[model samples]
Target: MTKKGIVLWALLPFFLGGFAQEAYFPPAGGTWEQRNPKESGLDPDALQEAVKFAGEHEYSGPRDLRLAILKGFEREPYHEILGPVKERGGPAGMILKKGYVVASWGDTRRVDMTFSVTKSFLSTVAGLARDKGLLQSTGDRVATYLWDGTFEGEHNGKITWAHLLQQNSDWSGTLWGGHDWADRPPAEGGIDDWKYRPLREPGTVMEYNDVRVNVLAYALTHLWRQPLPTVLKRELMDPIGASTTWRWFGYDHAWTVIDGYRMQSVTGGGHSGGGIFINTEDMARFGLLFLNQGTWDGRQLLSPEWIREATTPSTPNPNYGYMWWLNGGGEREWPGVPETVYYAAGFGGNFIVVAPEEEVVMVLRWLEPSQIGEFVRKVFAALP
Candidate 1:
């Protein structure tokens, strides 16, 4: 045989492997591989013990009430719980009420890319800054926190914190499609040079776009004078006693993998539209913090009033809040859900649901991008 043919044969495994690998997309699936919580230098048994305590006790308050809530769900599945949404296009769903895991289907252990849900998490951090007086108000102009000329035009100048939060920024710029971020000219000269196309007058209508959230992250990091991850860790994650093993996947739009875990953080981008890596349990704890009105262990991470305001609908669209998705009303409504239930939904079915009335927090992480609405319905149906 020819030498060239022999060389090609030798390289066949790598070539075939590359072709067989799945493309990086939202909600891709497989299976849950158990990870040693201790290897990440965290005690899995402690977490389990906490879960057990939560299941056994009727939490009163003051000490680890969040853990109590999670344990409650683990004791039993909701009376009417429906699914893992295991259809060919269904979501890999998990149910947690008061912090305990009740049911999980599909690849429950596999970390999946959750797009846009990252926006809600970013909003929480932004809210934290505002709570600390680092950021004045959601009404503050983007120019107040960021450089005056960072964004161009009257619309950009008129862009307020509220506008960005509600998806009413009117800036029609997008970083997707064939548009390459590497190609855009630097922010220089007048704001006009940036030339943002307006969708409507700022604060007029809702249109979900990526750049608005990315810009919000940029503005937030600037005001806090810290990197986005640091701010989030100090203000939100650490306060909630979340797992430290969880790390955000930077720049690669993918899932956040826990230490010693083999999953990737869902996509690497600074934008809040998507780019947070957290485990299902930590996600539940985060939701529980909100459900408890931002207080944990007698300390207020965020003001209760701020929680109400942030989670409540701030626009004509009743389903959206300050980056969170309100669940009571939307194009897809769920049955048996109280009017008070709200959720932070990410693309590909990453859900951190807070139902205040029921004291329920459900976190669903899946590898199927298109089954979000279906999963939402299943969760509601599963409620006892």
Candidate 2:
């Protein structure tokens, strides 16, 4: 080969790599910079229409979350508020393309309860633990690390980290005043029947039980040797330049003594109350982290492998991955959207959608729950 041909071949990789890294990443704090919609191949008029549709389809529930929680889960026996809850603001959202804000609406800075979106954060905490070698593999039984009676029984003993993350643990017990069977009880069964029903083997089914979710949080707290919130702030939020306004909380009575230090074990959702209370920008930051395959700027905050495992569909639930919801052409998928898209969703219509192929991170708060698919479809329609 000619000398020129060899030189061109060596420079080819560098040129391609430059294009891969050209997307902008916002600074840690202050105002997030904006980019023209045209640059991202998005139609400005269609993007505005998407924002308008979000505003017009506000969540129908009362702004007073206390009442909303009570009414939403009234069918569950012994359901009652046990933690902090605040009135929520109206519709707020932000859309980012290549880490630059292209469109936003409402009060993006308003902090409010994120409900089950907290699960995805909790899942991240677990990922950090594994990355640091706190606990071994996700397939390892929980009883190996947490020998303190939480996983003592036959059904519980078989539970693994992956099972808990996938919401297929079917862990039968009570934690922080929440009974596993009492959470989202079957429509026709009484308490006696529901409580004593057959237990499915761990990892064989997906059940959205807050009690079991809190159990995972409890185990993770023991593994980390500190409160989950503190670990998150030091390791994630602060590094990502998140505001200090966000807070994570647990039930009022959920405290435990660890290594002579008394600390609270946070909950994974705001079922009774208390979870993540964060604004849209922070949520977008998190989504952007995932969209970039766990890298921020150039530093690796989370391993790409961890992010991939967290988004990959689990066996029992095609629409769920380590707590993040996947759009894997399942029943929950948004029609016409790419299956590569995944999101962190919560009650009351809060969602942080990360579309890797589109280089988009969207935060939506308080849109009608049933309209999410249609809302997402509209957002994708704006893309060329």
Candidate 3:
């Protein structure tokens, strides 16, 4: 076997048995043919109940999204011009079984900001690069590729691609006008406490800092020698037959020159109002691709090995894999879902839940995050 094939087999341990049956996939050009709930082996009444429950549960946090947004950024008024920024929408979602749409609620076509879900997509690029031998190994230091000031310092040099994917890089730096410590600043710490905090050893401590994630975007962009979105489009998105309407956003202040070409380092969340702003159907297509083990139609869009690594639990946080949430071991992130189920979840309950065992790919948006377990329970109960 070739080196690529050998690597794929090594990664197959997590995806031991999946997609053991055949199923339908939507064609290109944003067209889909859905199955009736009964035809898809779903309980129609139960599915309706689940959909109803999903529509009723609103994001129970702040009444205004801007307040939450400013709080998250902790900076001056965000006037970034690069997006496709999110205009908060009402509840929207869809349920897919074996790649066929079984049921849907709200306006799945409405493009809304899927906050942290962008991290999964960003991590997907890293997976693609690794599969192509760009990074050689996840253990390879990110500094090897990004020799720029981004990874120049002693502490940052120790960070690796795996550490970034696992959110344990603990990389300290300011990018796009946001400080690493500024993100989710501790209530007890004063300014010096956050800025001068000693750098925790990379991969030892898992911290969800968007600045580091944006740094990943920046480094990946530098290595690819092209914009991350362009790479994602040519590589994963188009091959999956996703929509032409979808977009990945970066902050206005995040632009930089690479190889004499200008590029923007997109964020991993809509924290400062720019990340992934995609519609539900497109997001479902992305989910379904993973459910299909990164194979769309006959072509393998992403290496099974990368998908395996992405879904497997990180040592620091069992609940978090490479940007996707693992739902069974140390903590049950989504109760009643299969242990094999993993998901790309965003703030405000935007999620793309994939259950390989159940042959299901479900998406939900704008609901309370706390209510996802109940909602997921309903979906699983209604599954065929």
Clash number for each model: 25, 0, 0
lDDT of candidate 1 over 59-153, digit per residue (tens): 13222222322342232212111111111122344444443444444444444344457777878877888888887888888887676365566
Candidate 2: Cα lDDT at 141: 96
Whole-model lDDT, candidate 2?
0.92
| Best candidate (score: TM-score) | 2
Q: Which of candidates 1 and 2 is the stronger one according to lDDT?
A: 2
Clashes of 2: 0
Checking candidate 2 for backbone clashes, the offending pairs are none
lDDT of 1: 0.55
Winner by lDDT between candidate 3 and candidate 2: 2
Report lDDT (CA) for all predictions. 0.55, 0.92, 0.83
List model 2 lDDT by residue over 59-140, tens digit each.
9999999999999999999999999999999999999988899999999999999999999999999999988889679999
Global Cα RMSD, each model: 22.8, 1.8, 5.7
Candidate 1, residue 206: Cα displacement in angstroms equals 0.8
In model 2, where do residues sit more than 4 Å from their true spots? 1-20
